[model samples]
Target: MSPPSQFSSLPKDLEWLILARVPKRLYPILACVSKNLLSLVRSPEIHKTRSSLGKDSVYICFMHKNDDGVGHTSHWFTLRRTKNNPSTEENQLVSVDDLTFPDHAEPMPSIIACGPEIFFISGSYVPSSTVWIFDSRTDEFRRGPSMNVEHSFKCVGLVGSKIYVVGGYRNDKIHQAESFDLKTQTWELTPSPDEERLAFSTANVSLDRKVCGFMYLAAITICYDPRDGSCEVFDLPKDRWWETGVCVMDNVLYVYYARLGLMWYDTELGLWRVVNGLDDMKKVRSVAMGEYYGKMAFLWEDSACVGCAMKEVWCRMIGLVRSEEGGIVGNAEPAQLMGSVPSGYRLQHCLSVSE
Candidate 1:
């Protein structure tokens, strides 16, 4: 027989299902229940929630543009794990590559993944060049396709087997976006929007509650919709992009942007709401948030160095909190959520999102 729970009618499996979507901060609160509930904390099914994690904490790489070309494109730095069990102390930044770049390969990569295993996408900083993939954990490099004939930031979007390389410059007219498929491992030029978009970003919010998929941005801020071959921009005054957040099920595209140190999102209403940060929370940049170990967690770039944007950052831990409304908050530190969560275990979700 199961122990006492607020959800008495819920089957054990159903209970785990609900707890799986709960955030890290809320886990401690939930853990206070009976021992049976506590034991369920370690169950595999709860942690097996993959689609939720992937959608929330989109695995993205840290990228920057060099004013004076000297580094590897911009992602010269790559994050590497220090030791299996990260201590309660903050994860100090570690360099991924042990090799020195040749002069020609000076500008290596501007983008790198925040999580482990999936490594950095090193692209050509110069014109007519091939991009490379470097595994920070193993410190190895594999050459990728030449980025769209020009050296500009590629706003990347990945859905299942395909990777979308959106609007970027190639020294000519600001080129539109293109799509690359991992299955076939090939690039196909998609339809472009009416107007040429530069420095704009593409974010995904799944329309269905389960099984993550893609949706379009139709806010005032002009965004290029490749499917429609139309140049559309969301109103900057309304809302632009959102910061670390979850995926939405509503047919409308809910976009969040990390601008001005706050997590603001433009729902279908076309207004940006300032999701004021928690007392200790800064802008949840880069790293994603989602269920980790039967509880929700927030992941972000741990910038250990000052003044150096190229410095490789590691995934630091944080907990997430949900409210009566669907709103979410993030908080994480060792000895906090799942105080019993083994230090050796690294819980990462697809991207940060609130259930």
Candidate 2:
């Protein structure tokens, strides 16, 4: 076999390797030189083969300010992991408006969530908040039933198949959080018992993953003991909010997280100590869930912002000490998976968000 002859000239596989190693800027030149190269780069098969998982990645939405009073679909963009490392505008964003259902009607991106095979985004420039289901694979967004309430919607999210909505206001005294179940096609509105405590802005950011404590308390892992108002917990396995722990500032459980094993808030003693080891963080925005080198942990975005504001987001990686289920980290997911600006592509000395 004599070492396969001259490596570079001997085979087509070697040619692809040579081309792959070449600077990407040279790709345009490569394509220009031959029609075959152009077809290869444009091949849909190439993209399909690269990833067969369907598009399960989380997509973030922003209210893109535009010339029109109601923004156009073209302004709505989605970011995903890319091999090219996201530099150019094309790499940074993929317009999902076109992928929406084949209706010429306007697309108001709202109520974004990552379901198993779809990202549900619904909103309306009109008084009614319309729900839209987007199929990432088909890139089509289909309009669903319109919300009955008239005021306008502030926030929306989902736990499993149930969609929860908390609002801005219809009139006065309409303080409520509405729950809609897609599986049953049933819509139920509950006068938000907690409306007095959380205002409109709070409701708008209500679904924001940060402010909620993710320990064993409220909704995700273990049942939260609502007996103590101090904290909010989600038992993930059961997929419901529980009343286990309470809130805490310092050692006082200003917020309770039962799963993290937080039991008490020493406001009377006025001291703060982890009655349970879950006393890591009091708040967070978005989180990433995965095993880091077989150890579960979290990466997060401290604040929530729309558009490609990863440049504005504060990205942090927290090493979580895993329990039986998964690791926890606050402000974690969006920043690492989709938000942060790519190295060398984004300038380091960007100005502060407020500035």
Candidate 3:
């Protein structure tokens, strides 16, 4: 006869409750204990329970230049609680060796994380309508529905259940925008913005349920409302031309300006406000920001080194709170050395996936 189940005595609901309370990092070990536990750990019901209880976990994935500097490689790492000191919540970035990205021609594909999945949109010298999705929970890669229009040098934004792909080159013309519906598992064309506005955009983000494409060179931002298919263009502040280090957390857009420190866009005031409490923070040569379980996962490189030498990558978790005065405040921890990479490896992107 088979061994008696470990959770045989507990009720089904009680078993789920107990597992939901456990740290997600421990789920792998729990899965190994029994086949039933393995199935439970990978079930959507368990993830829903954990998410509703506010027990979501964030994992950071980023890309850097390969050691030889010919191409780029992606890596996944998550903040795991220290084993030596279980009492404290001190965590460190441990590489997730099981999760791997497939080889693609694009040096850096536009990537965004929604829940446990990360979508990588295609962008290369040759226009292609391919998309690859990486599932953090299962550590697997699957091809998503391709975009309707082929594009190169594109920008992507995630709003609700849809991912908007905008602004790229196709047949020597600016490709029209398209969106992929996660729920329906299909792609549809979104109304195109001005050809000139679409061509020069370098980055895009979802804000206020709309997709905003940023063109730093022209100091212009095009806002596209997927609901109404309307587009609006506005000029950015003179000093806010550099927007490569931008991310959204809790419906608020945050940008890291090397000369000015961290700032957030005030939707009501239509201006950028300084995120108080980070005044003493030192500026870095390059930085990337992501939402880390309601906090900001900030990563940066101190040196402006070039070529194949090794350099250190630093990280800090900043907690954000709203002030009574209608401003945002940041409580940042001391910087920690996350890992090292080749000097030629620029921190292309940083995204946090919740499981």
Candidate 4:
């Protein structure tokens, strides 16, 4: 009799259980091994199993110009760790060449991650109502239901099952704010603030079950609670805030300031407290921060590559701990060179998606 296949030896349930434990970053490599493994990796059941086991992985996705010198053509890449030296902590960014945004999609679309999917809301000089969803598991893109109103230069926040899009240029005031229901895959208009015109938001995050939109230049923050459809506007703690480096981790709002390093907002105290550690790290001129799994991931350009044709992007993963005195302390790993991009490519967005 012919020998049984290795995959066929185990029960399908048991095989799924084993595969669910594999890190998502290695899924692409696994998919290339065989059709059976590829099917398993792309299967919804495997992802559901991984979610049940709390094995979600964080991936860093960023965009840059394609080397063809075609202006406005952007290429996407995911920063992954190099496996050549598994014992070391070095990591590298690999290009996901197969994946590219729709030609009409904005170069710097407003992006928000929901589970294994990343939603790219359309934006351009003229507002567009297109929404593109990227599935990390299958490495495929699908068109999602468009938003209620055409918006550009918007900020997005994910609260529960719905994604809240706020503060963007739109034709009408009634639909300036809206939410997309992931479960139903429908868009609905939400209440906007009392202001006749909403100021453009630089960054947004979900905290305390509310969507908070920040306007850095104006030093104002608009907090909208979907539960009651009420909006509250407050002044930011700092006169000048870094617009791009704001993220929420463990339900706490963290913002990185050039002068202050990393700081977390204390909602109860209504103040920004400097993280205890990271005093020894050098200052970065620009940074994009995101929540990587349970830790804070900071992406910045390597200052050493001043005149180089390709600039290196460095990433530092920081673990936050609560001290006995009720203060926050950060344990940061030495920065590693994630990879390099063209000198002209700006770090537009850095976000973590769990798969």
What tens digits encode model 3's per-residue C-alpha lDDT throughout 23-119? 6545656777788888777665664465455454446555676768687677667654455753343556677896566745766677777767888
Better of 1 and 2 by TM-score: 1
Off by over 4 Å in 3: 1-71, 83-88, 97-100, 240-244, 304-308
lDDT score for residue 259 of model 1: 50
TM-score of each: 0.50, 0.41, 0.76, 0.77
lDDT of each: 0.41, 0.35, 0.71, 0.71
User: What tens-digit string does per-residue lDDT give for candidate 1 at 181-243?
Assistant: 655767777765455543343333222111121222433334444566554444533334333
lDDT per residue as tens, model 2, 260-287: 3323333334333333243444444233
- By TM-score rank, best first, the candidates go 4, 3, 1, 2
Per-prediction RMSD in angstroms? Answer: 10.9, 16.6, 8.7, 9.0
Candidate 4 lDDT at 165 equals: 79
Residue runs of model 1 more than 4 Å from their true location after superposition:
1-93, 98-125, 136-138, 146-154, 169-171, 199-222, 235-261, 282-316, 332-355
Off by over 4 Å in 4: 1-73, 83-90, 105-107, 167-176, 195-199, 237-240
lDDT tens digits by residue: candidate 4, 1-355: 1123687578888877887777565565677777878887766577556545645444554445666855465556665434574223455677777667774536667778787788888865557789899897788999999887787666678887799877565555434578998789899988764542233576678888788878777777777777656777766666457676788876788888887788887877777889998898778756788765446778887645567788878888788888898789998998888777777776656667665
Error of 1 at 169 (Å): 4.4
Give me the candidate number with maximum TM-score. Answer: 4
Error of 2 at 100 (Å): 6.6
